[model samples]
Target: MRGPEARPRFGLSLRLLALTLVFVLLAEALVFLPAIGRARVVYLEQRLAEAHLALLALEATEDGMVDGDLQRRLLGHAGAVAMTAYQSGFFRLRLGPDMPPRVDAAYDLREVGLWPPVGDALMVLTRSQPRLIRVAGISPKDPRVAVEVTLPEAPLRRDLMRFARRLLGLSLIVSLIAGAVVYFSLARLLLKPLSRLVAAMRRFEAAPEDPGRLHTPSTARHEVGEAERTLARMQARVREGLIEHARLAGVGAAVARINHDLKGILTTARLESDRLEAQTRDRDPDLARTTEGIAQALDRAVALCAATLSYAGSELPSARPRRLAAHHELTLAAQRLHQAHPEIAVNLDCAVDTTLSADPDLLARSLDNLTHNAAQAGARHLTLAAHTSNHQTTLTIADDGPGLPQRARDNLFQPFAGSARNGGTGLGLPIARELTQAMNGHLNLHQTTPSGTTFHLTLPT
Candidate 1:
C-alpha cells in the first residue's frame, strides 16, 4: 500500500538495529553469569593463600606464637577475621578470635568445584547486611594441609558489585558498538536493496504506464538481483496489458457509438434478403436458397455486432449445426472474395466433396473473414483447398501475397493487436477462430513466410 493514506509503522532498519542490541546484550549476559560466579571463587582462593602466608609469618616468630596485636594485624591483612591451618586433622597454625562469632554459613572450598555457585554469589550480592562465612579448602601453598578462614561476606559482595558495574558498562559499550556495526552492515547489504524493490512496486503501482517508473535491473547476482530482473519483465508485460486495455476501451467507446446503427443496417439487410427470397422462391430454387443463406448470415452478423461491444468479454453464441455441401460453401466464399476484389485471382481445389456438419452461416462468415483478410493484405492469388479424412474436412486457404509479417505472426490470433497495416482493428482472424471453435472445430495458421501463407480450417464431417 502506498500514497499518502497509510503511514509508515517502522522501518526494518531500526528493528534490525534494536534486535542486534538485544542479541549482543544477551551474549554478554551469557558471559557475565558464569564469570561473576568464578570471580567469587577466585576471591575466596586469594584469602586462603593469604591465610597460608600468615601461618608462615607466625612460624618465623619467636616460640611460634604472635601477640594479640600482631595476630590481629596478620588476620586483617588476609581479609579474614580468623585463620587456621590443619595437617592430618590437627591444627598446625591458628590465629585471631577464640571461636570467631558463630559462623552464619560454612563452605568447603575443595568440594565447590571449578567455580563458585552463581546462586551463592547472587545471594551475597542481595544480602542486606554482612554476615560471617567459613571457608575451608586445601591450602594453596600446601595441598596436604587444610586451611579455613572466617571472613565477612560484605567485602566479597562489595568487590562483586563493583566488578558487575564495570562489566555492565563495558558490555553496554560493546553491545552498542557491535549492534551499530551489524545494523549498518545489514542495512547496506540487504535492507537497502529490499527497500528499493518495495519502492519500485509502489512507484509502479502509482504510474504503471510510465516507462520511466519501470524497475531497472541491478547487476547484483543475488536473489534480489534476480527479483529486479523479473520485476522489469513483469512491469513490461503490465505496460503492454495497459496499452491493450486502453485500445480495447477506445474500441468499446467507438462500438457503443455505432452499435445501434450497425444493428439497424444488419436488420435491414436481413429483411431485404427475406423479401428477395420470397419473390424468387417458386421461380428459382437455387436463387431462393442463396438468398436464404444471405439472410441467415445477416442474422449471425447482427448477433456478432451486438457482442462487438464486449471486446474480450462475451462468449460467441452457440453453433447451430446442419448438413451442408462443403465444396459448394467454399465456392460461394471464393466467388464473394473475387467479386469484392477483381484484382485477385481465386482458385478452388475441390477434388472431393464431403458433407460437413456445421453452422452454415458461421462457416461462411469465418471463411469470408479469412479470405477478405488475405485479400486486404494485398494478395494477388488465393487458393481454397479442401479434403476429407477421418470424418473431418480440412480447408486450407493459401495466399501468395507477401505472407504475414513477423510482428503480426507473433500476435496473429490476438484480437486488436495482430494487424500489420495502419488503422487495422485486427479482429478478423480472432473472430474467425472464435467462430470455428464455436462449431467444435479449429482455425490455425498452417504456415506463413515471404513466399506465401496458408491457414488450416478443420470441421466435423
Candidate 2:
C-alpha cells in the first residue's frame, strides 16, 4: 500500500497490544509467585513453632509420659499427629507421618522444631510412619510416660487454599489494572504520534500529490525521530524519481521523432563529402592523403550521428564482430578527436600487434567519448594503448588532465547526473560504457590521480 508522496505509516495498535501483553504477563507472574511464597512461608513457620511448644508441654515420668491434654492440644496446633517411642533411657517424640499431598513434606517438617539442624535442612519423613517416645523419670507420678497424638492436616490445608485463592484474586485484579494503566500511558505518549503518522499515510494514499506531513513530536532523541526522518527522505526521493521517470519517457518519444530528421541531415553531408572526394585529383600525395582523411572523418561523423540517434531513442545498434585491424580504429579515433580538439595532443601505443574480434565502429565511438571526456576534464594530452594478456584484449585511454572528482568517480556511468564539472550533461560515460558492454566487452575506470585519469576497456580475445 506504499506509493510516492506517502507519509510515515506507523503500527501503533500492534505495538500497544504487544506492550500490554508483556506487562500483563509480568505483573501476573510477579504477584502470583511472591504470594505463593509468602503463604507457604507463613504456614510452615507457624507449624514449626507450634511443634516446638507442643514438645515442651509433655512431661516424662518413670512409668510413662503424662499430661495427655497438652499432647492433644499440641497435635491440634501442629495439624499433624505426635508419636512417642522409647528406646534405652531416652524417650523421643517425632512428628506424625502421612501429611496432605498438597502440603509439601519439606515445608511442613521445616516449620516444626523437631527437624534437625545440620549441614542439610533436615527432612522429616512424614510418609514413613516412625514411632517416638517421651522419656520419664524413675517414678510413677512423673509426667514423662510416652503418649501419642494424631495431628489433623485437613484444617491447615483448607485455610491455606482459601488464603491462596484470595491472594490470587487480588493479585489478578491489581495486575490487570496496572497493565491497563501502562497501556493507556504508552498509547497516549508513543502511540499517539504513530497514529497521527498512520492517518497522514491514509491521506497520502487518497491523494498522492498533496500527501499529509508527518511532523515528529520533539520529545526525545529516540528511534521515533530517526524513523520519521528516514520516511520523509524516502518519500521525497520516490516522488522525485517518479517525476523524473515520466519526463524521461516523454523525452525518449521526442528524440525518436528528431532522430529521423538528423539522420537525413547526416546523409546529405555524406553525399557532399563523397562528391568532394570524386572531384579532388591532387598530384601531391600529402594532399591526397589529407583529403582521404577528411573523407574518412566525415564518414565517422555520420556514423557517430547515427549512434547518437540510436542512443537517444533507446535503439540497439547492430554489432559486426570480426578480426579487424586494431591500429586502424585507434588511428581513426585519434584523428577524429584531434579534429574536434586541435589544442589537445593524441598519442597511440600498440603493445600487442594483433587484430581484435569486435565491432570496430562501436569501439571507435567508445574511444571517442572517452577522449572527449578527458578533454572536457581539462586534459592537455591523451594516450591510447592496447594490450593482450591471457586470451583477453584490453584497451586503455590515459589523459594528462585534472582527474575526475570523487563524486563523478562514484557515479561516473550514471546518466544525467553530473559531478562537480560545469555544463556536463553526464551522458558520455554512460553511453560509452553501454556501447562497450553491448559489444561483449567491459568498461571500467582503471585509475585516477591528481595528474590525470585512465579508463580501461576489455574484450574477450
Candidate 3:
C-alpha cells in the first residue's frame, strides 16, 4: 500500500553550499588577523619615521631647535602631537607641546613576536573610545638611535577600519568562489549521484516486479559508484527471485486445478485392485497375494496424492504430540527404511531409551522422507541415532551418500528446486522440515562433506 512520497526537508546540496561558504569565511579570518596586525605596525612605524624626519628639521637649524609655529607645522605633518629622539646619549630632540595630556596607552614595536601585535590590533578595533598612544621604535636613520611618537588613536583606527572593510569584501568574493568550487566538486560528485540513486530506489519500490525500473550505474570510481553497482546487482537478484516465485505460483495453481481428476483416478484404481484381491482370495492363493500387493500399492499412491495436494496448499494436518519411547520409535524408523530400500543397510543406535514428545505420524513421515532422499543420493547405509540431554532429544540421521552436491547445498530445503539428482521431486527435505516444524521440532542439515552428510532433528523430551 502506498502512503506518501518522501521529500527532503533540507536538501543536501544546499547544506553543502552553506557549509562551504562558512568554512571559507573562517579561513579568511585566519588570514585577516595577522595581516591586520602587521598593517597596524607598519602604520605606526611610518608615523615614527615621519616624526624622525621632522626632528631632522631641528637638526637643520643652527640651535638644534625650531620656532613654535614651525614645530606645530612639523607635528601636524608627522600625524603626532609629540615626538622625541635620543642617539649616543648626546643628541636629544623633542618637538611639539611640552605635554600631550596624560599618556593613555603605550606600545613597543621592537617586540619580536606575532602575538603581541595581534593582541594590540584586536584591542584597538574593539575599543569604544580613542586615546593618545605612545609608540617607541628603533630609529630608521641610525641603529643606535631610538625614536618615539605620541598620537591620537583615532587616525590609526580609521585606517584599520578601511582595511577591514576591503578585506571583508574580498572575503565575501572568495567565499562565493569557494562555494561554487565545492558545488562542482562535492555536489556533482556526491549529491547528484546520490539523488539519482534515491530516485531509482523510489521508482523500484513503487513497482518492484518491473524489470525496466532497475538503476543504471555510472562509471565513476568512487564510493558512489560502488553503491550504484551494488544496488544494480541487488535489484537484478530480487527481480529474478520474484520471477522464480511467480512461476512456482503458476505451477501450484495448475496442480490445484488437476487435483480432483487425479484423486478420482487413484480412487478408482484402489477400488478395482481391492475387488481383484477379494475375488482371487480362494481361487488362487498365489495370485491373491499379488492382487493384495497391487491394492496396497494403490492405497499408497492415493495417500501420496493427498500429501501432494496438501503440499500444494501449503498446509499440514494438525500435529498430535504424545510421549513415545525413543528407542522404539528409532527401531520403527529403521524398519521402514529397510523395507523401502532393501539393498541399503539400516542402523539404529539408541544408547539410552529416552522419552520424546512428538507426533508419531509426523515423525515417521519425516524420517521416511530423509531416508528415502538418502537412498536416492546413492546412500547404501543409513544411521538413525538418538541422543537425549537437557530435556531435548536430538535424532541424527547420517548417511554415506558421497555428500550433497553444491547445487543441493546452495538451495537446501527449497521446495521444487533443492533436489541434486535428476528426476527427483526436490520436495522431500522441505516437506520433512515443514512437518518437523509443525511438530514443534527442528530439522537441520548439520553438515555436508565429501565423506557424508548429517541431518539433525531436535525435538522436546
Candidate 4:
C-alpha cells in the first residue's frame, strides 16, 4: 500500500542526482591534473628567473663579487639556498648561503614533457618532510646556458597546497552547478513524466471505472510521450470493458426475470395444448395436428426459457460427472431435435465407441441446443457426428442451411446478439459454450459457408 510520496530514500531522483554529481566531478578531475602540473612548473620557473636576476648584481661589480650581506639578501629574495650559472661551458657558483646538507630530488626544466609534470606534481604532494631540491632551467632573457638553483621543498609544497585547495573548491562549485543542470533537465524531460505515469497507474488500479483517473496524454514526440499515449489508450479500453461487463450483468438479471415468467406461461400453454389434442383426436385430424404443433412449439418455448434462465443465473450448475458413451448423448439430442422438427432430417454418424467422463445432462443439453438451432435455421439436413482420438471425444454438428450472416457470425457466441434468424433470442450457442466449458470441454465453430455450418465440441476422454 505504498503511496507515491512514500518512495524509498534511494529513489530515482536521489540516484539521478548522485550519478550526475559523480560524472561532473570525474570530468573536473581530468582538468585538475594538468592545471596542477602547469601551476607547479610555473612556480619553479619564476624562482629560476628571480635567481638569475639576483646574479646580475655580481656582474655589475668591478671584481664580479658581492658583500656577504648583499649576497644573503639576494639569496633570500630569490627563494633559493644556492644559485649557479652555466655560461659558455663554465659552471660558476653565483650565490650560496645556509645551503642544505643534502638534496632530496632534482628536476631539469629542459627535460620537461607533457606528462612528466603531472607525475612530478603528484610526487611533491605525497611528500611528508621538506628537503632541498635542485632545479635547472635556461634564463628567460639569456638562453645561452642554464641557471641552476637549490631550494627547500617546504615553500613549493605550501604553494601547491594552496593551489590544490582553490582547485578543489572550484571543482566542487562547478560540479554542483553541472549536477543541478543535469538533474533538473532530466527530471523535467523524463523523471517527472514517468512519476506522473506511475501515479496514474496507481490511481487507475484503485478505481479503474473512474474516467477522471485517465489523464490527457502529452504531445511530446518521444518515448515518454508514446508511453503516455499507450497508457491512455489502455485505460480507455479497460473502462469500456468494465462498462460492457456491467451492462451484460444488467441484461442477465432482466433475462432471468423474463425467463421465469415465460417458463410458467409456456407450461400453462403446453397443458392446454395437451387437452385440446385429446379432445380433437380422430374426430378432427386437422385440428389434432394443429394442437400437436402448438404443444411442440410450447415445449420448445419452455426449453428455451429454461436454458436462458440457466445461463442468466449467478452461476452455472455444478457438473455431475459420470462415464457415459458420447455417441448415446449425440443420438438422444438428434432424436429430440427430429421430434421437434419432423420435416428436417437428422443423420447421426458416431464412429466413437469410447466413453467420456462428463456431466451427461449438461452434455446432452449443449448438443440439444446446437441441433435445435440447426432445425430452426430452416436446415433440411442436419448431421451429428462423434469421433474419438488421442484420449478425447469430438462431436460435430453440421447443418445444410443458409450459413450465418455477417452480423450473427461477428457475435456468434454472444447471448442475444448472435441470432441468425429474426426473432431468435441468440442464447443457444452461448449457453452451449458455457455449459461445455463448465464440464472442461470446448465448443468451436468448425466451419461456416454458404453451403453449410459446422460446430465442433471436444471433451476429454
TM-score of each: 0.63, 0.53, 0.62, 0.55
Scored by CA lDDT, what does every candidate get?
A: 0.87, 0.64, 0.86, 0.88
> What's the candidate order when arranged by decreasing TM-score?
1, 3, 4, 2
Off by over 4 Å in 4: 1-6, 88-93, 97-101, 245-461
Judging by TM-score, tell me the better candidate of 1 and 4: 1
- Judged by lDDT relative to the true structure, which candidate is superior, 2 or 4? 4
- Of 3 and 4, the candidate ranking higher by TM-score: 3
Q: How would you encode candidate 4's per-residue C-alpha lDDT over 1-461 as one tens digit per residue? A: 45455668698999999999999999999999998899999999999999999988888888878889998899999998889888886975478854444688899998888889998888888887878999999887589858998998889989998999999999999999999999999999999999999988988987889989886898999999999999999999999999999998998888788889889999998999999899999799999999998898888788778867766774765788788887788778877887898898888887557677789889988988898898888799998887888888888899998899999999999987999996688998998998999888899998899988999999988
lDDT tens digits by residue: candidate 3, 160-263 = 88888898899889888887997779987888899899988988888889989999998878899999999999999998998898998899888876875788
RMSD of each predicted structure: 14.3, 11.9, 9.4, 10.4
lDDT of 2 by residue, 1-461 (tens): 54555433645566667778677877776655555555544554455445554554443445334555654565766554554333344656443433422322322222323213211111121223332322112222223333333333444445556776786687778867877888888887777766666665565455544434433334456776666666666666666776687898799768766766776876787677666666665545566566677777666656655655666767565778877667777888889988989999988898446567788888888888899888888998999888888877788899999898888887888875744376556778888888888888899999999999998988867
Cα-based lDDT at residue 65, candidate 1 = 88
lDDT of each residue in 1-461, candidate 1, tens digit only? 45644736777877888889899999999888888888888899999999999988978877878999898889889999888899999978888877567889999887885445777888888888869999999888888889999988989999999998998899899988999898889999889889899989888999899999999989989988998999999999999999998997788777766876888988998999999999999999999999998987887778767656555456555899988888898999988987899898988887645777899889998999899999888889999988889999888999987889888999998887898665466888988998999998999999998878899999998
Judging by TM-score against the true structure, name the best candidate. Answer: 1
Residue 73 CA displacement from its true place in model 1, Å: 1.5
For candidate 3, the per-residue lDDT at 326 reads 83
Model 2, residue 319: displacement in angstroms? 22
Candidate 4 TM-score to native: 0.55
Worst 10 residues of 2 by lDDT: 117-126
